[model samples]
Every structure is written in structure tokens, then in C-alpha cells.
Target: MSAPENTPQTSLVHSAYRAPDGFEAFPVGIHHASTVVFPDVATMRSRDWREKLGYTYGLHGTPTSFVLEARLAEIEGGNYCRVTPSGLAAIVMINFALLKSGDDVLLPDNVYGPSKDLSRWLQRDFNINARFYDPMIGAGIAELITPDTRLIWTEAPGSVSMEVPDIPAICAAAHARGVRVAIDNTWAAGLAFKAFDHGVDIVMQALTKYQSGGSDVLMGAVIVRDKALNEQLELAHARLGFGVGMDDVYLVLRSLSSMRLRFDAHDAAAREVAQWLKARPEIASVLHPAFEDCPGHAFWKRDFTGAGGLFSVIFQPHFDERQTDRFVDSLRLFKIGYSWGGAHSLCVPYRMAGMRDGWQRQGQLVRFNIGLESPQDLIRDIEAALMAMQAD
Candidate 1:
């Protein structure tokens, strides 16, 4: 009564189906899928993709991405999270979801460089006004908020200048004016500070940094404690069609387990090196939030639990651009690069002339990203670089 085994029907049934259910493992399985199949037509039609009750499409999210999202949300003390292609993408998503024509957004003068660029682009293309406020404005940010202001962006320990801000005060100001507060919490890695606890509505991070820890992956996440705000971000994320590779998500998950350890190591080593640099005669100033001389060190002491491995040092007034370049080039250990939160130490010389509004320090500024290298070795590298500059 049965059909022949070699028949086309039998071949199709056998080749199309295989079940690996109930497989247990320490690591989450990488689910590389674009199309998900349903057991029945009714099941497929009834599924709500937006709620994350079940898998819908690869672009929206996969099991791997969901796992990472949940973990990141928990770490950030948020209820919902959406991962994006990069930190900048997350910022764009927030902007697109929240801002419209006749709306305005406020940014810290010393925010991440690319963020300012994106704000300018939005202003040009979308007619959304972009305003820059001093990072230390704190509650005084209220003065800048207008009837048209819809969003405010904050960055603690302002990017390369390393000036900490009064996050709680800024949040209070923004919230009182009915404006949403979003912070670039990359420096904290969502570990050094509790963003939502300070009244921040949206918290974003460049997971490419500490979460990946290898400096090999580039991914970002936006976390929100409110459901409505989360819905807006989710809609923008889906429309943008941003999707992260499963392998990269898995790498971040793997690194996240060791993130705390690595962060602590980096924090300790950086303090030692910074102190050494501060003591050197060639240094004009060390812009570290943990130290009193930094612009908002008091706020940093009040808000942050710990400092990360990023800080900038201004060379003596005599060190010109050429000398600074020589110093950066002569380093044997610290590689010159833009990003941070890796095992390899990095350094970059920056001209602070036009980047900030109130910057008064003379001489060239060099930012350092301390890595897993021994503190003494990094110090020696800087010492040698200084010596090299002296010789030249």
C-alpha cells in the first residue's frame, strides 16, 4: 500500500525535514535564518511579529539577537532594548523616531564627534534644529530648552576632553521641559554607572567597545525603560532594516562574561599611567574625571562608580603639532587609533582648537586608551615617546 521509497514525494519529505530539538549547550546556538516556517497557515497569520512573542523575520530579530538584547537590557536596568548596526545608528534611530520638522535636539558641545556630524546632517536634510550645550551646564540646560525642543543628548566625561557632567541635574532639567534625555553611555559600558536610575529615558552604548572587548566587532544597543519610547525606537529600527550578524552577536555575548574583569584591569592600569603622566614636566594637564583638575570632577565623583581607561593629556604649551605627531608616532606599544576598550593600548593626538567652545588650555592634546598591557610597560612607552620628542 505504501509508495515506492525512491518516489519524488518520499524524497521531498525526507530531505526537507530534520529536528534537533532539546539540544543542551553552555553557549547559545547561532540561528542563521531569514525565513521562519510555521506549522500551519492559521499559526502564521496569527503571529504578532512586533511583540517578540515568536520569530518573524531575520531583520527584526533572531534568537541570538534576542538573547543579547535581554542581557543588555538587564545590565542597563532597562525594560526594552534594540540592537543596531553601530552606536551611531542607534543615535540616528533615536533621532528619526523622536524628531520631526519644527523639532529641535540639544547636544553637548563635546559629544562624540560623529554624533555632532549626524545632528548637522539632520538639520540640513530634515529641518530639525540642532543646538550644542556645554556638558557642565547641568540644570542650567533648562535655559537652552525651548518649546520646540524634543530631545536632549548627554555624554559624561565629554568624549576626548574627558569632562564629566551632572547627569542627574541634566536629566531633571530635560524632563521638566517635557524633553527626552538620551545618553551616550559608551564610556560606562552600562557598567560604571546606572543610567536609568538617574532619570535617563534612553540609554545607548557602542557595544563595539567593552561588550566586544576584542575591538573586532562593531555593534550598538539602545535601551529604554518606557514601553512607548521603546515602541518608537523599535519601529525606526525595523524601518532602517539594520541587522547584526549572529557570529558578532555571539562574540559580544562571549566577551560580556569577562567584561567586568577586563574593565577593572583597564581602570586600574589607566589610573597608574595617568598619575605618572601628571607627574611628568612635559604634561600641562591631565583631563581625567577622577582627578580634581578635570572640568567636572566633582560631578564625576558624585555620579560615577568608577572611571574607564580613557583620558586626555595636554602637552606643555611649546609642543607643536609636529612635536605631538612625533610623540604619537614614536610610541612603541600604544597604537594610534580612534576607538578604545580593547586589549591593545591606543593613542591619538587631537587639535582641540575648534572642537570645543570653552577650551582654554594651550598645547596639543593626546588621548590614550589604556589596554590590558602592564601599567609599567605603558608608562615606559609614554616616557620613551616623550624622550623621542625631546630629541627632536
Candidate 2:
């Protein structure tokens, strides 16, 4: 048989070279593709995108993405998983999957700011009724469930306000009403809190934080034990085109092995700093779940095995917002930023009055994300920042 001659362009596209087989490593192989190839047309026709048994398209998932999803699901103790571009994207996927026009959703008062915005958008544009309830509502959540209520969103120890909701109570109430409860379990990274065991129907995590461990990737995942629920989420994923990059998936996979260790380090360091802040006269309140004074602290202690680096503090009324801002500006190690779970510490100040309904606290609120740095160094930096605030 003779090979057919081709133009330079055709030759470039038609190379038949193949890599040797039997190559294997500890790391998962990254498979990047847009148009997935099948051995034959019949095989392609039989392949289902919903099933992870085989690849049909890049958006649906590749081996790399599938591996990442499997790893995340395993970590979270879920049977199925779908990855999204960001934590917010995971929230959006769940909302779009389960709710439609005329459906009602319940959100915690202290839910993530962006999720709150999303609920409002859904109400305004999509006609989905969005309502907010106290994060500590617990069993009382049953009172909020209406005939139209289809979903309830919970964030363990609300991201900014730091109120750890009683998940089992809320889940019991929601499930009784034939409603599904979705939780933003990003704070725990599925290591500290087990959402499924706590009776949550869907668990969403922002892989951007501890999972990445590098602060370089932004990814999220929705995990479920129910096959039907996973199907709904997968359909939404496909319709919304929520595809993630393989490189990011690889980065996450590379860091997954060390996530628990890093998470523990962050936990230990955070608790130490939180304890120090609790004693400071300049700080009115420390809003870490592990702290006894934090709202719903009992619930946190009951349900969680660990608290990650994220926590908040309220400056004394005498310090005011200006002084707090000065203190934050004076921080040398804790950089001002949003999102947590990296090697570098971060600080963010929130206006509770503006963020919450009837926020009664008078002092300014500041959230801290303790990194892998030494707790002593972070405390020293905070001490200096406090002195700077006093000087100002």
C-alpha cells in the first residue's frame, strides 16, 4: 500500500506519530480536548454524555476532569460530582437545575454576598421567589417552607458573619416539606464538616481555596449521593456550558493530596490568632466558629471537627470604621483581599449594617484569613497594625 501525498497544511494536521504506551505516574494525566474522538460512529452514538463511563465532549468532561470530579466526590463522600468554573457558578448551577419561574428558594440571611445577589436576580428576572432566613433558624426553618419552596440554601458558619447553622435540623425540616437543601460547604473544604452525613441533599465547594492550595485556580463542585439529583445538575451543567479547564483541574489534583494537612495548619494557626483577638480590648467580638462567643458556636462544636482559616472580628465601638480601616491598611503580612484558603493571609472588612437585615452590632467588622504563616508572625503583624491604628 502507498501513502497518499498531501500538501504541507494537510501533512501538519495528519501526522500519525504515536507515543509509546505503558507510561504511568502518581499524577493523573491531563487530557485536553474540544472534539472528542470515538473509535467508530456506532460507538459515538451509543456513548452518553450524562454517563461518566466514556467521554462524548469536552464540555461534558474529559479524563482529567472526570478524575478531578471523582477525587472531589471521594473526598466529600459523594457518589457523583460536577465541577464548575467558580464557587458562585456551582451555586448558580444548583439554582438553575432545581428551580424555575414560580419556584421559591430559601437562603440564609448570612449567605455569601454573591449568592444573595444571585437570588435577587433570580427573583427579579426569573420570577423565582427568593427569601432570606436567619442562619441560626435551624428547626424553625420549617416555618419558612411554603408549597412553592423548592430549595433551601445553607452556609455553615455564614461566610462573613460567622454563624454556624444547625444543618441537621434545617435539613430535617426542609426534607419534610419535599424540599432539597443545598449548602455552601466551601469553608470546611469537606474535611471539617460532612454535609451528607449531616443530612444535606447537595454539597457545593469552592475548590479555589484549600483544594487548590496555590491561590491560582478558581473552581467549584456540586456533589450528591442521589443519581437522579446528579442527572439534574449534569443537565444544568451542559445547558449552562459550565466547562472547566484541564490545567486547573490538574492543579487541583496536584494539591488534593496535601489539602488536609494544609487545612489543619490553617485551622491551628487561625484558632491561635482568633484566641489572641478574643482577649484584645480593642476587639469587641471574634467571630470564629471554634470560639464560644460566636453565634451558633454550640452547633459548630456539635457538628464540625475543624474550623478552617476564615474568621472575623468586630472592633470596639471606640475604634470605629476609620480606625479599623487604618489597622487593616497598616497590616504588613495580612493582605486585603477577598476569598481565603491559600499560603498568604488576607483581611477584608465588611459593613454588617449594609450586608444584613437589622444588623444590631455597632462596631466595625473585619474578617481574617490566616494562611500557612506562623501564628506568632501573624499576631505580631496584627499587633503592629493595632499600634498603627492607635497612632492614627
Candidate 3:
């Protein structure tokens, strides 16, 4: 028989080249695939996407994504995990997984802004009832839970206003009423606080922050200790097709080892800056959970192991919105931005009165995401910004 000659197109489409096995390295290999291969029809038919025993399709997950998910779950003390495109997606997935039309969900008044918006949306279009409760309601939350209530969403120390809530108390109340609780634990990056240990049923983390360290990746994960709960979330995950890119997964894996170190550095630097602000005449209060003045500080002291880099400051009632705006703009190293848990410091001004109910504080609120910069340098930058704000 004559040897067959392959055409250029045919050769390109089906290459005989294959890398040898036993190739080991420190980094996890990035595996990108939409169509996963199967040995036979029986194997394909036997594989279940929910089980995570084997891969069925790229959307479900690849080896790279599976490794990332396992690592995240391990970090959060969870048994199962699902990664989403953004933190908001993780929130939505939880809502869709547990909630249905006519079901009610309780959210803290100081919840993340976009989460509040998502609640409004669910109420308007999905027939789901979303109610806002006081973040410090604690065991008082039992009075608010109706038979229709299915889920309760909490943000430890409300992201913007920085009021740490009593997670154990709220969880106790919710569990008594057969309601599950989910928390946005991004602020701590699953390092400082153990959400699961504190009674949170679902732990949602935004890997975009400390887990990415570089602030270049946008990813979120929902982790749960209960297998049944994870199954429900997996169904929603599959329906939503919340597949994350392999490259981004690899990036998170690379940063995971250094997350705790970076997180602690941020904590030290932030405390330094916060302490400086506490004594300044221009500041009213530093809303850090570690500080005594912060609401729910007692709860924080009782439960939390450490505080991360995020904290907010209220200008001494005298500094109006205009002046506070100038203070934010005058900063040299602290850039104006949203989100935190990166190498760069960020400052953002928020009008609290409108955002939360019963927010009677007199000062304009400015949030600080103290980066990995020298605390002295950050304080100097803030001092210069304060000087510029008073220039006129």
C-alpha cells in the first residue's frame, strides 16, 4: 500500500503532535476547552456534571477551573464551590437557586449597593419579595422572618457604611425559622473571618480583590458546606452558564498562596492610616470594625480574627459634600475608584443619607481601600489632600 499524503488543511486540523506525560511544574496548567473529549458513549452517559467526578463540558469546568474552585472552597472551609464571572453573578445565582416567585428574602439595609439594586429587580420582575432589615438587627431578625422568607443576605460590616453585623445572631434566628443565610465575605477574602464557622450557610467571595492581588481579574465564588445546598446552587450555575475563563482561574491560583500575606499587610497599613484619621480634627469617626466607635464593634471583637484594609471615614460634619469631594480629588497616590483588595489604594465618596435608612449622621462619608503602600506615605497623601481641600 502506498503511503497516504495529508493535505495542508487536513494536517492543520488534525495534528499528530502531543506533549508527553509526567510533565510537572509549580504552576497549574491552563486548560481551555468548550468541547471535552470522552473515551466512549458509556463514559459520557455515566458522567454527571453536578458530581464534579469528571468533566462533561467546558462550561461545567475544566481542570484549571476545578482546581481553582477546590482551592477557594478549601479556603472558605466549604465542601463545594462554583465560580462566576463577577461577585454580583454569585449573588444572583444564590437568589435564583433558593428563591422563587412569592418567596421572600431579607437583606440588610447596609447591603452592597448593587445587591440592593438586584433585590429591587427581583421584586419588580420576578415576583420575589425582598425586604431590607437593620444590619444590627441580630436576634431581632427572628421577628421579621415570615413563613415566605427563604433566604437572608448579609454583608459583614455593610460594605459602604462599614457596620459589622452579628452574623451568629442573625444565623441563629434565620436557622430557627428554617431560613438559609448567605454572606458576601469579600471584605475579608476568607482570611480574617471564617464565615462558615460563624454560621453562614453560603460564603460568596469576590476573587477580584486579594485573591487576584493585582486587581486584574474579575471573579466570584459561592461555597457551601452542605452537599444538598451545593446541588441546588450547581443547578442554577449550570442554568446561568456562569463559566469563568481558564486564564483568569490560573491567575487566581497564582495569587492564592500570597493572599494572606498581602491581606495582612493591607490590614496593618489601613489601621495605621485609620488611626491617624481618628485624631485629625477634620474626621468625625473611623468606621473600622476594629475601632470601638464602629457599630457592632462588639460583635466584630467577639467573632472576627482580624480586619482587612477596607474602612470608611465620616468628615467632621463641618466638611460638606463639596469639601469632601475636593478631598477625594486632591489625593495624589490614593486614586478614585471602586472595589478593593488590590495593590493600589482607592478612595470613593458616598452620600450615605440616601443610600441607607435612618442614616442621620451629619458628615459626608469617604471610604478608603488602603493599598500596600507605606502607611506614612498614605497619611502624607491624605494630609496633602486635606490641605488642598482647605485651600479655598
Please report the candidate that would top lDDT against the real structure: 2
TM-scores, in order shown?
Answer: 0.96, 0.98, 0.98
Shift of residue 358 alpha carbon in model 1, Å: 4.4
Model 2, range 3-39, lDDT digits (tens) per residue?
A: 8888899989988789999999999999999999999
- Model 2 scores a C-alpha lDDT of 0.94
Each prediction's whole-model lDDT (CA): 0.91, 0.94, 0.94
Per-residue alpha-carbon lDDT of model 3 for 160-248, expressed as tens digits? Answer: 88999999999999999999999999998898889999999999988888999998999999999999999999999999999999999
Overlapping backbone residue pairs in candidate 2 total 0
Give the distance in Å from residue 99's predicted Cα in candidate 1 to where it truly belongs. 0.4
Residue 37 lDDT in model 2? 92
